[model samples]
Target chain A: MLHIVNKSPAERNALESCLRVAQGGAILLIEDGVYAATRGNAAENHLRDALSRFKVYALAPDLEARGMGDRVMEGVATVDYGGFVDLVAEHKNCQSWL
Target chain B: MSEGTIKKFMFVNRKAPYGTIYALESLEVVLITAAFDQDVSLVFLDDGVFQLKKGQQTKGIENKNFSPTYRALDGYDIEKLYVEAESLAARGLTEDDLLVDVTVMSRAELGKLMDEMDVVLSF
Candidate 1:
């Protein structure tokens, strides 16, 4: 599994690159990525299809801070600090998108 | 052994996109390395989170806001995303305000994750 941490638009391309290699993977949203949760956002739609049945997660803390926790799209789970470590253990590799 | 090893690669985005080329240029490298079949992931922290915001107008700045490009990323197969929890709290940003889905790890945890990676690239 692989993890992507995109906080910028330029970094999104990197996330796109990772989708090509994703076999068993997970996508986590934190920091600025929380903005993707907005209604009709294009990035959110793209991420949904890119993961393709793979696990997708986001940070609740970030969501709440930005006042978007309740607005996050469904299907993607939210992970906490401990869950973050679990992701590291679960995935063979991790990369930063930004 | 080194040549065949499929080490996990991670990207840490520390700055907002647009003003500096580091984030955008670093993104290009991410795609290039993925084409090489490297396992990759991404993290957003500090001002880096600003890259994913919505409704940004770059007209006045004479630059194109790159946030919309994030939607096209799925076409390239790059979707694994992450963020730094403390950073978000410090910045007063929430998942709802972000542009994508990702995991929020603590600073210590994020650092530890990097230690476990075969490759760690930050922009």
Candidate 2:
């Protein structure tokens, strides 16, 4: 499976590009990318439109660092670093965009 | 910067190529990592998108334009190239105008992709 990694403000753009081929891939937001959990970012709407079936995840550390833990969008699950390691084990390949 | 059987590596490039040497430095690391026979991929987003634009005039910046170096990425076996779809459109660019061929995707899809990585490095 293809894993999409978002790491910066441009993550919204990166995420959009990966979703074009996300028919069977998953998306995760980490580091500065967690800002998308806040309201008003076009990223939320893009997710609703492109990855209706894939699970959405955010790095817990990044979310807290941005002070957005409470503001995380609905349906977005929080995962810790260990959980992140689990994901890498599950998927054989990944693609990351900053 | 990874251990174990980390066969696949993903590079999240977020900064512009010229302002700092981060992009160039990362490229060197990537090439060395690939020398270990690891699978490598790169996603250009934010300022990183500016790295691939054609006709970069870095002379006034007193820096060498490394755009040509990208053309050689394939030679290093690091060719899973990608770009942010919205970013390209936001900057009024298309794959045709880029120095490389990249697969574009939506934001949500990119998130999922980042989760399934054996190794991830950001620059």
Best by TM-score: 2
lDDT of 1 by residue, A1-98 (tens): 44565463334554443443334457676687656644456677766675464677887788788878777776778878788788878876665554
Instruction: Measure candidate 1: CA RMSD.
Output: 14.9
Best-fitting candidate, measured by lDDT?
A: 2
Q: What TM-score against the true fold does each predicted structure earn?
A: 0.52, 0.60
The segments of candidate 1 whose C-alpha lies over 4 angstroms from its true place after superposition are A1-98, B1-5
**Candidate 1 docking classification:** incorrect
Error of 1 at A4 (Å): 22
Look at candidate 2 and tell me the lDDT of residue B102.
76
DockQ agreement of candidate 2 with the native complex: 0.18
Tens digits of lDDT, candidate 2, B1-123: 545555667787878787788899988888898888888888776677888888878889788887888889888877788787877787888878887777887655665666666777877
lDDT of 2 by residue, A1-98 (tens): 54546545443455654555455555677887777655566677766564466777788888888778877777777889997877767777655554
Candidate 2 residue spans exceeding 4 A from truth? A1-12, A38-42, A61-67, B1-15, B33-57, B71-123
